[model samples]
Target: LAPMLERTTSAVVNISTTGKVVVRDPFFNDPLFRRFFDVPRQRRERRISGLGSGVIFDADDGYIVTNSHVIDKAEDIVVTLENGQRFDATVIGKDPGADIAVIQVEADNLTEIPLGDSDDLRQGDFVVAIGNPFGLGQTVTSGIVSALGRSGLGIESYEDFIQTDASINPGNSGGALVNLRGELIGINTAIYGSGGNIGIGFAIPVNMAKQITAQLLEHGEVRRGRLGFVVQDLTPELAEAFGVAHKKGVVVARVEAKSPAQKAGVRVGDIIVSVNGREVENSAQVRNEIGLLRVGAQVQIEVLRNGKTRTLTASVGKQLKQTVSGKSLSDKLAGAKLSEAPEDPSRGTAAGIQVVKVEGRAASAGIRKGDIIISVNRKRVKTVSDMKAAIKKNPKTLLLNIQRQRQGLFILIR
Candidate 1:
């Protein structure tokens, strides 16, 4: 039976993408001497390859399933089959927030693997992974399901990842995590190496892949409904801070003016308990569910406010999209952009800034897209208007207290 299962592994393939990008050695578009940033000359573009395994998702046309991060910036992507046929693969669709992407190899009669139900998977379920790990080609590793519904890594913007211990490594970014039947159950995404694997690897559940892939095939992008409310996870101190006996659900710290949350009567200090009928345990879950919902979805969200549970129906708006490198639509600072908060609870930070737009000075200030701006001139800016007003009033020569990477950064807005 094991040998028969081993035979099915041939459908799995390796993916590597190459691309060129412009990067500043010190800073970008600097006023002084105009810093020399490396631009993608097409000639200077490096072979930016990521080692990941993919399952032959379709028997016809040869669709491959892998992590979005693997081929995110690839100017050219190469897919290698188990039977040793390599082809130039085109990206059909990619969900950067979900960390999943679909690629296609132009071939027919390809051997493909079947997909298993991730919703039915349980902890301690045995699984196997086949991928190119550490540049080693087509390696198979095995372990058990460590946990389910894992989140809060900030790895992908939206996450409800399947946690496993299948010996996934850096090269295993987009491999297949299979059930005992050799059916693709998950796409290996991240390794929980606090230092090393400690028995934790994350995979994009097959169910999510199916939905996202369909969207990608339909639209070149993944779109989700955005609930415009700033939120924070409930800490013990926060529970005491809000005078709540239980540290349950995320607390609405701020709501964007005219946002769906504000429009639906959601407010600061409200504890969000459920969305679309599913209970929200933490901020990650909230982000996950919201991301899963289509844009313009009418979702029913429940919140605990003033010691009472109240439900509100909200029509979600389209979430702002960014590039794989994390560049948003606008730039608020030379380094940071600020906007309304999101439904995903994983948004709040220790310093606290609701990052909304990334553009202009923010993008030029060596700041990334989606960064939360917590303070301005040493004063905490809690609302979108606050940051905008402060920046507009102060002009140049201000310090921005930004939150990203779960840490605080003071950027100079000159």
Candidate 2:
């Protein structure tokens, strides 16, 4: 353990952060607010700190890898090596969908860890996790790989994680999950424990991290193709109803009127069993897989329709980027041709409200940015000017059928 610690601890770094942030009061006209408004507030924020661990992936010019959730939303980030030398780091690019990030620092002759093939790992393989757990500095604990090829946990958009019994805790996120040979097989990410190691842990597979990190560094974001179809998991009832031979592929819920799926001759009630040559186990898997394809990539698609298996080659379109990668990709959506709704209380937010206040029930209903309210409770939208007019024609709770870009869905907001 000492030799292992000595060999790798130099690459392990402690992250500290401080930032100047604005405090928005939920209430502005209250007496408490007025009393505090008279006092002069400092322009600079006080020292705020947090702890997490990272590994040196590239040491010559200083590149590191850690969990995106660790440094996400942080106003400032400072990294400290095992030698106590602190260097401020900048966020290069991050993918919340992947829970991985690449940070760069300046150093020479630094000992770095080599990434191990996560796909090569199996159950019962010895693993080690090192991190600044509980902020007590670098700590190392060992356990066996409890599971491999694990999926469907919904930990992130793309998950082929390696589950281990390794001791991962609060400060362990973004730490290195190394094999017995001290090679990094995965990034220590989530833990299912009672404030300590309960023999249940999860790590993002190294291959997934490598693919996303490389793409993010090159383009500042990742781009994938969109197959114009709404899909859901195959339930027992659905499986029986559809009479699918195997209940693994995603069942198409709906196809937009002018979507790529419709153009490609896809229809509702069609079971999308595979893409290219890979089998899709569920709807989320379908989304994740399709999202990995670049725009304009042509691929063979297999779908079960009318109890017959037919293969069709659909030309994939670029998916309007998801919000997880930040605003840099939003320009590819509409090129700044969007407008916000009026903020007057006369136009107070509604369940079917648009252009403002995306939180609450509507967003959970899966309403996303750039979606347009086509109808409220089946009432048709004639024009943008008639949205408020049409809303006044309906009741308090609205059942919005939204048209998001080329796809359509339902959003219930109040």
Candidate 3:
């Protein structure tokens, strides 16, 4: 263990970040006093500090990998080495969905850790975790791989975690989880216990990190594949209804029109069995499989459709970043594709336009996909056309009655 520690400890780093956040006061916008009394227009600034850990994967190029949450909203980041040397770091790229981030520092005589195959990890294999726990200098703990491919934890959008019993605390985030050979197999990320290690910790697989880091290095952001489809876990009843042989699949709930999935003939109720030759047991697995692929990459999807297995090929599409130009109300609502709400007897579907893709003011106002706009300015809107007509009335502020996940909401868009 000493020899391996000597070989790998240099790659582990202690990360510290500082930033300023606006402290909002409740009286800043007091309408009663604003009419007569003079109010200060300035808001107070509060300094925030955070501590975490990181790994130096590329020593010569000075590329350091860490969790996205570590340096999120950080104005200044500094990475300290095992030898007490520190360097100012700059964020290269980050993927919040995956909780992975890459930062770079210009330094000399740094050490790089050897990357290992996370796919080769087996349960009960010995592993070591190195990080700065609770802001206490560098700490190391040993444990075995308790599980693999753990998901559905709601830790991130895409979760393919490697579970371990290593003592990973709050400050252990983004630290290195290495194999016995001193090869980095994972990045220590989260613990299931209350703010401390309870022998149940999760790590990001090194293979996934490698792919993300490569893309971040090249494009400054990961261009992940988007199939433009919504999926739900396949239940026994759904499997039987879809005539699927087994329940180990995801059922397509909705496919966006004009999307790659729709272009490839994918339809609702199709049971997705495999993606790119990899079997997916649930919607999360499907997302993890396709979300890691580069945009424009071709994926072969095998689905059980109408009791028959069919293969469809699709090229991943990129989400359009639409911006509004004109000042008209229609322009404010432009770039969003809407569809009529699907009928559901169980919930009694609402009469409204389901927001599929949103941009411009609609997105700026926090309108999200899947939100059903039931009324525009108190007038019932059963379709996109009705909503448009109501908006064309040119109200200074549009009050949207929205139904989100069966909950009603009122949002004002100006």
Off by over 4 Å in 2: 1-10, 25-47, 147-160, 193-197, 306-308, 321-414
Residues 10-89, model 2: lDDT tens digits: 77787765654333233553347758787442233344456788989888868888888788667778888888888888
Clashes of 1: 15
Query: lDDT for each of the candidates?
Result: 0.74, 0.69, 0.84
Note the clash tally of each candidate. Answer: 15, 2, 0
TM-score of predicted structure 3: 0.78
Worst 10 residues of 2 by lDDT: 342-351
User: Candidate 2's C-alpha lDDT?
Assistant: 0.69
In the order shown, what is each candidate's alpha-carbon RMSD? Answer: 5.3, 8.5, 5.8
- The candidate scoring highest on TM-score is 3
- Give me the displacement of residue 59 in model 1, in angstroms: 2.5
lDDT of 1 by residue, 1-414 (tens): 378466677888888777865444333344553435454322222345565677887878778878887886788888887778888999898877788888888987688888788878999999988888876788888889989988777676677888987787888888888888888889888887554456778998999888888788788778777877767788888878777787567888778788887888888889888887777778777777777778788989888877777999988887654322112322334334445443344743443455544434455565675576677777767665565566566655668777775767888856
Could you give me the TM-score of model 1 versus the true structure?
Answer: 0.77
TM-score of each: 0.77, 0.70, 0.78
